[model samples]
Target: MAWGAAAILFCVWTLPFAELTGTSVTCTFSEDCVLPCTFKASSDEVIHWNRNNFIVHSYYHDADDLEKQDKHFEGRTSLFKDQIKHGNASLLLQNCNIQDSGQYSCHPSTTQGAQESWVDMKVHAPIRSVNIEKIDEEVICSSQGIFPAPNVSWTTDPPTQSDMLNNSTQTTQDPNGLYSVQSKVSFMGNVSDYAYICSVTSADGMQKWKTSMRQQGGNQLPSWIIVVIVVIGIGIGIGIGIWIGIWIWKKHQTEKNRDGVGNPGDQVPSGAFIAPGHDHVPPDEFGAEYELLTLWVTQKLTMPGTSQDPSAIREFRGPLEPSLRPDTIVSVTGLSQQTSLVQVGKSPC
Candidate 1:
């Protein structure tokens, strides 16, 4: 019957481009993306487009054309002018780069006959970069390969007295050995200093990617404890100079025994004398009245100004006064009981 109606019109024109149906489009980087594709065609049906398979755009018969576009999608493709007038061919791409990301399709052809749809386009590029290091007094953090897979976290500022972290993306080996994937940390060199971060999360999870760094060294101070405090301050200044030389030699031997000196203006010697006394007399001055009063008080103290009387104190004052009635001869010698040399006018009573 005419070769089965030309193989049923060539399987109805390849079954509307193999029954297209898959859509998803996303962009980030001067943003803009749409690519959806729906077509229950009618309104003078006509729409066609493909990507990753060539053919740029079309709207046949009503004439709105484009094709073979791949010079980096020249001027950024387009279509969605009010859903291509109800037949909806969707496409609208602009400022979106990243190789205009994957899959896209559409095929309408009206007169109540063909239809198809599909789309999937994503293109984002804002991932920044950072990495820092130091170990054994730690300070390490990383951001692996960084792409759609990101969601790392770690931050510090004034707060760190022993911190540890690991956002599961761990794998390390640096110092030129190559092997990386990081977001791990450890700090506590007795209080770490500020600025330390590694934030990343963007697939519409609110973009981020910061990698700061800082780590000041510890303070120092021990030189054998300043040489043992200067050798205990020179042994307490030689024990206070031997206790001030034994207190100036016992105050110079108590001022030389109060100057009764071993030297220095010495004198006082004349038989070093000292004594004084006087016996009672008045027995009516008997016995020749005390032998003429001991020869008138020893001839008036030997007449030489009483020996320069320095109050002539002393020389005696006791025992030896007897001469009253025994023929009172009373010729006693130089009496020491208050001066008496005897015999002035005897009363030898």
Candidate 2:
């Protein structure tokens, strides 16, 4: 029986004794995070947390000991001192950053045994707002304050081939280790023909943001083109105004001339005849030649004993008759004795 008990004690001591527990922890950038660990409770307890064999935090003798802590974790790591007796060896990491993301191991020891807990930490700065703008022939999409880099993609309402889309993207990291991404897509044809969409995704694919832009009709026209159109419109308006003003002035002059011609005191040129009881005969109606012919015919008809026979009427020379070559003679005929009248140059004589 002693041999059996000795063998059992040897077996217990030889068996695998180190307990290992693993969990995942997600942390937001610039925020506090806790890596949980638990062990068997004991009066004399010891705790140590390490990442990649680098000391993150250590506790012993019922107090914190950070003299050997990594420089990167200085003033940024702590332990829950009151909870250590309760088998809680959780590490409080302050102001978490992207560099702090990795696997961490928590080791706790006591009179009972020692155990190791693993925590996989991930630090993320999620994507926020996506901004899209159209500048000339290019469309730009951008986002700021992201962690672990980001991805950018461009799409159109009427989807286009990847090769056909002329695009370029760039990402930059600021001093705070946050990423800013910008993408530009150049278009060859009319901007109003398609709608451009830009999507920004975090590196971990846990967050996404999208923005779309469509060119409006007013925005499609170039600034210089708009200016030219306005200038042309003004020129046309001024030309029309000038033409109307000239037409009105000419019409006024014409009306004034007509009124002057109709005045009773207006003098007529010498040798020009005016019909009885008429103040004036506008030259536009009956020319000077016609008036002179009418006057000569009237004087001849008023003479006493003038021949009344139509056959006797023949060509006769008069004071008002215009001089003519021998080949061209003025002839007066087709007279009516009762009315004592003749036709001369389309006017009744």
Which has the greatest TM-score? Answer: 2
Model 2, position 26, has a per-residue lDDT of: 92
**What TM-score does each of the candidates earn?**
0.27, 0.60
Model 2: per-residue Cα lDDT over 143-251, one tens digit each: 9989889999988877878777799999999998999999999864754557788999888887888898875543365667888999999999999999999999988
Runs of candidate 1 with Cα error greater than 4 angstroms are 1-18, 23-26, 31-45, 48-92, 96-107, 110-112, 120-125, 129-150, 155-212, 219-349
Instruction: List ranges where model 2 is wrong by over 4 Å.
Output: 1-16, 191-193, 218-349
Candidate 1 lDDT, 1-349, residue by residue in tens: 9999999999988664436577676666456776777777476767777776787677676666765566666677777666665767777777776556777778776766676776777675555566776544445666543335556677677554333442246655443222345665655435545566666675568677676666555522346776788899988888787777777776665443222222223322212211112243334343222222122111122225754555642332122333321111122222222332323333233
Local accuracy by lDDT, each model: 0.54, 0.72
- Report the poorest 10 consecutive residues by lDDT, candidate 2: 331-340
- Among residues 3 or more apart in sequence or in different chains, the pairs in candidate 2 whose N, CA or C atoms overlap within 3 Å are none
